[model samples]
Target chain A: MKAIILFGHGARDARWREPFDRLAQLWQEQHPSTPVQLAFLELMQPSLEEAVTTLAAKGATDLTIVPVFFGQGGHLRNDFPVLLEECRGKFPNMTLSATPAVGEDLAVLQAIVDFGARAL
Target chain B: MKAIILFGHGARDARWREPFDRLAQLWQEQHPSTPVQLAFLELMQPSLEEAVTTLAAKGATDLTIVPVFFGQGGHLRNDFPVLLEECRGKFPNMTLSATPAVGEDLAVLQAIVDFGARAL
Candidate 1:
């Protein structure tokens, strides 16, 4: 089965994980039975390697890595590439597709407005 | 000069700070005369109180606190408001207007698309 991994920047604050977990749970509510997992670049557990290996062990040959970051700034474009490169080396035979980081979606505009969290 | 405070979730990993700092610098580049400061909600240094106190000391009466978070998730909508409430009490006479958190702007759509960080 295909697996989706949500990668968060990972924070030390326990409060920080709440939203990420909530979103993951919300995503699961829509995709019940879908194999989804979480990985942190740092400051948290389940490093990218750990998440990838776990999914691989579970027979997920086709994997999708979604950067849970806000923009395509350095993290999504630069650091994440490095992270995925390492993951790619580990799962060479696996077909992996890295989705654009969050906030890269046009649809998110309304969500932002709905949240009333917009500037200007 | 006007002042702006960018509040981050504060990650334990050094890598996570790069983007926030970079953006702070970029914003500075555009507004050379403006005094921009960085604060962390947790994990990092320069807490909200510190950032605000520094600004207040510098004669900033009309302040605008910008949540550097991605969405209105718990931190932006919940925790941050609480932080501001505390600040409001501290600066009772100060006029502070909080802009929407980042990613809440329609203009950010292009940045997201430009980053090619979209999932769908």
Candidate 2:
């Protein structure tokens, strides 16, 4: 089975995870076959490693991590790679891969522009 | 006149602003009459006040600020209001309003979900 993780830079505010929760729910609703999980980088529950373990336990052989951030900053460039490497080391049998930050997607940016246009 | 400002949380890495730059370019290209500016909360150039000033000088009497953040955490809920208030004080004649974070938009969230689906 294949699973996906929406990784975010967690914040001190509990409500900060609301969108991530919504993203996971949306993914699950649209892609029922692909199990979805929400993972945080820090200051939140279910770190990337924990999320991977949960999916691994559920027989997920391949996993994709999508960084739910607006920038490829130090967290994505530095912290994330180390964590991913650790996950790879721990889950040697599973195939793990990642995509560029969702912000890098043109459609995502266009959506934001549309939202601003509507607001104006 | 009316204008828009795409506000984002700045990062230490300069390359982090590439998406934001693209967003401004897209807005300018699509809505040339409205005019667009980029602002950052911290660690980047062109603060919100500066953006407001730029638009004000451009003869913009009404301005809309769109928070380009994923979650309404302390930054959006707490810090942003303070900054907006300061801008209002500095530019008292300009009519300024702000929308909820772009992440709060259903279309934006759907776009992210679609991006993940395509990657999978």
Q: Could you say which candidate leads in lDDT? A: 2
For model 2, state the Cα shift of residue A2 in Å. Answer: 1.0
lDDT of model number 2: 0.94
Docking quality (DockQ) for each candidate: 0.11, 0.85
Chain A TM-score for predicted structure 1? 0.89
Q: Candidate 2 regions off by >4 Å?
A: none
List where candidate 1 sits over 4 angstroms from the true fold: A1-66, A70-94, A97-120, B117-120
Q: lDDT tens digits, residues A33-77, model 2?
A: 999999999999899999999999989999999999988989999
Residue-level error in angstroms, candidate 2, position A64: 0.5
lDDT of 1: 0.68
Q: What is the C-alpha RMSD of each candidate to the true structure, in Å?
A: 6.9, 0.7
> TM per model?
0.58, 0.99
In the range B1-120, model 2's lDDT, one tens digit per residue, is 999999999999998999999999999999999999999999998999999988999999999999999999999999999999999999889899999999999889999999888887
Cα lDDT for residue A55, candidate 2: 98
